[model samples]
Structures are given as C-alpha cells and as structure tokens.
Target: MKKNGNREEFNREKLLKGIVRSAEKRPVSMDAITNLVDRVENKLRSLGENEVSSQQIGEYVMEDLVNLDEIAYIRFASVYRQFKDMSVFYKELKEIMEKDKKKNQDQDHSGDK
Candidate 1:
C-alpha cells in the first residue's frame, strides 16, 4: 500500500520506469535492471503477504541500486528518499564511501593470505 493507505495492483512497468530513470546515462544495462526488477518482484512475492508498504519496496530498490551503480543509486535515492538538503546527500555519500573503503581493505587483506 502507498502512504495514503490506498491499495493498487503492482505494475512492473511503473517500477521499471523508476529504475530506468535513475540508470539514465549510466553503465547499467537494461538486462541488469530487468534482472534486478525480477529479483525484487520475486522477493515481494515470496513475502506471502497480501500487502506491503511502498516504503519497504523503495528500501529494497535502494539496496539493490547501491550494489548496481553508485551514481544510479544516488539518483534513485534522491527521489525515493526525497532528500531534503545537501546534508542528507553528504551523509549518504559518506556511508557509501566508508563501505567502499572497507570493501577495498578487505580485498587487500585477503590478498595477503
């Protein structure tokens, strides 16, 4: 359900449109986006719930986008999250940077083995 408590059927195209908008001019391919959407849709179906909040859906997309493309992730997040100001954007970018740093460190450590 949406924030307004109204219920509607899920539209795959609608979801695709949102993701496509974020992926514009990015390296992410249509196949990847379609697969991501498939995964999200499959996940929601697996929930076995009659209804799920729109917020939850958005969160799921954000999770997937972050792994797909950073630029696309930020683009989608700015809209899905409705970023208020530069501070919010800064915080999110910082988190991504921190995680990336940690990931690189882990890879470096693993290579030492």
Candidate 2:
C-alpha cells in the first residue's frame, strides 16, 4: 500500500525505471540496477505477506542502493524519504558517509593480516 493507503500491484518494471532515473548519468550500470531490483523483489516475496507498504519498498531500495551508488542513493533518498529540510538531508548524507568510512576501515584491516 502507498502512504495514501491506496493498494496497487507491485510492478517490477516501474521499480527498474525509477532506479534507472535515479542512477542516470552515473557510473552505475543497468546490470547493477537490475540486480538491485531482483534482490528487492526477492526480499519482498520472502516476506510472505499479502501486501507491503510503499515505505517498506523504499527501505529495501535504500538498503541496496546505499551499497550500489551513493549519488543515486542520495537521489532516491531525497525523493523516497521526502526530506523536509536541508538539515535532514545533510544528516542522511553524513550517516551514509560514516557507514562507508567504517566499511573501508574494516576492509583495510582485513587486508592487513
């Protein structure tokens, strides 16, 4: 269901198109975007629920996008999350950066051994 409480069928093509729009002009490839869509669809199906909310789908998208492409993630986030102000948007960016920094640090240490 949407935030407006309207129920609709989940469209894989629609999801793919939105990701494409967000990832446009970026280094992200169609293969990566398609895999993200496939993963999200698989996750939703695994839920075994009759219906899922748009918010849930958005979260799923963000989860994968964050790892796929930061710019596209931010773009998708600004729309999916509807940031009310710059502060909120900045906060989100900071969080993503922090996560990325930690990920890099972990990889660095793993290679040190």
Candidate 3:
C-alpha cells in the first residue's frame, strides 16, 4: 500500500506538471496521465476519503491531454463517484449548474450597484 501510495503521489504531481507543460505547447505524454489516473484510483480505494488529497485530484485533472478549459470538475466526479445510472449523474450535474448559476447571479447583482 505504501509503495502504491508513493507511486500515486508521484504520478499525480507529474500529471499536474505535464498539464502546465502542455499548456505551454510542450509535448504531452499519455504514459504520465495513465500512470497518474491508475495510481489515483488505486489510492482512493486503498487510502479512502480522508487519505485522498485535493492536490492529488487537481493534478490528475490537470493532465496534459485533459483539456482543462473544456472539462469541468463535475465530469470527473461523475466517474469518480461511480454513478449507477444517468439519473444519478444528472442530479449531481444539476447541483453543480445551480451553484454556478447562483454564483453568476450574485456577480451580476453586485456589478449592477
């Protein structure tokens, strides 16, 4: 477990760095993202919730090929939460949209006055 944890942490870091590199038009490598995701999933299972770090998740999502601007964290949560069906996925998605809507509304109101 410790070995896997170390590997996962490393992969997570690499993925984040890879994203930054790729955003700069540098080469993006799949090996890095695959290793990162594999390690993260394993860690999430083996380590459980409290053990899984936000940095790790952020790094995994920031992978070079991930296209961060085109993807939302909710998308990751869908797969990570392992939704049993479309309904469950949509429910989670609705919540996210609502939150974003509220945030935008607040910003608009604030800007008006």
Candidate 4:
C-alpha cells in the first residue's frame, strides 16, 4: 500500500515537471494565463450560481490550464461546494452531464427548431 502511494506521488511529480517544462518552453501570455487560472479557480469555487462569465471561461480555455475540462472542473467544484449528501453531489453531476449532452446535440443541428 505504501509503495502504491509512493508510486502515485512520483507520477504526480513527474507530470508536474512536464507541465513546468512546457510552460517554460513557450511562456503563456499573462492575460491568457490569468484568465485560464481564474476559470479553474472560479469553476472550482462557485456553486448555486446560474451563470459563469464568458470572459472568465475564455480565459481558462486560452491558458490551456483546464486540461481535464469538465471532470476536473466538476471534481473541484464538488469539493468546493461542500456537498451535504450523495444525492446533492449526484444531482450536480447529472446536471453537468445533461448540459454537456444538450450542447453537443445543439451543435449537431444546423439551425434552431
């Protein structure tokens, strides 16, 4: 068990190192980087809110910081929201999934019905 924990930590460290190298090679612009970080932060922070700002979302995407996109965002948001019960957590998950599916479905259609 301890060995597995060590392995996981090592893997995380290696992944972080790779991200740092990539960051160093082509430094992300401050404006873009700030936006992405903000998205990741806000997406993880806010809950019970109906809308997220477009500029903030764009900033997060431009920075390439939200690598996990919806999953990571959802995980982070769940913890941040402090879910009172499994039901609440699952409800949030379903809402997010439904929203994503609806978005994809809309994209498939050329025009509004």
Judging by lDDT against the true structure, name the best candidate. 2
* Runs in model 3 lying further than 4 Å from the true structure: 1-10, 13-70
lDDT of each: 0.93, 0.95, 0.53, 0.49
| Candidate 1 C-alpha error for residue 62, in Å | 1.0
Return the candidate ranking by lDDT, descending. 2, 1, 3, 4
- TM for every model, in the order presented, reads 0.95, 0.94, 0.43, 0.42
- Which portions of model 2 miss their true places by more than 4 Å? none
> Using TM-score as the measure, which candidate wins?
1
Better of 1 and 4 by TM-score: 1
lDDT of 3 at 48: 58
Higher-lDDT candidate of 2 and 4: 2
Worst 10 residues of 3 by lDDT: 63-72
- How many times do residue backbones clash in model 1? 0
Model 4, range 1-113, lDDT digits (tens) per residue? 12223211113233333333334434444454445555555553564444444344334442354343555445444544567999998987797788778888989885766
Superposed by TM-score, candidate 2 places the C-alpha of residue 28 at a distance from the truth, in angstroms, of: 1.0
| Candidates 1 and 3, the one with greater lDDT | 1
User: lDDT by residue for model 2 over 21-103, one digit each (tens)?
Assistant: 99999999999999999999999999999999989999999999988999999999998899999999999999998998999
Q: What is the model-wide C-alpha lDDT for candidate 1? A: 0.93
Backbone clashes under 3 angstroms, per model: 0, 0, 0, 3
Provide the global lDDT of candidate 3 against the true structure: 0.53
Model 3 has a clash total of 0
Q: Per-residue CA lDDT of candidate 3, range 6-111, in tens? A: 4233345554454444334434345654664666567567755545555556545544223432233444454445679999978866876786688789998997
TM-score preference between candidates 1 and 2, better one: 1
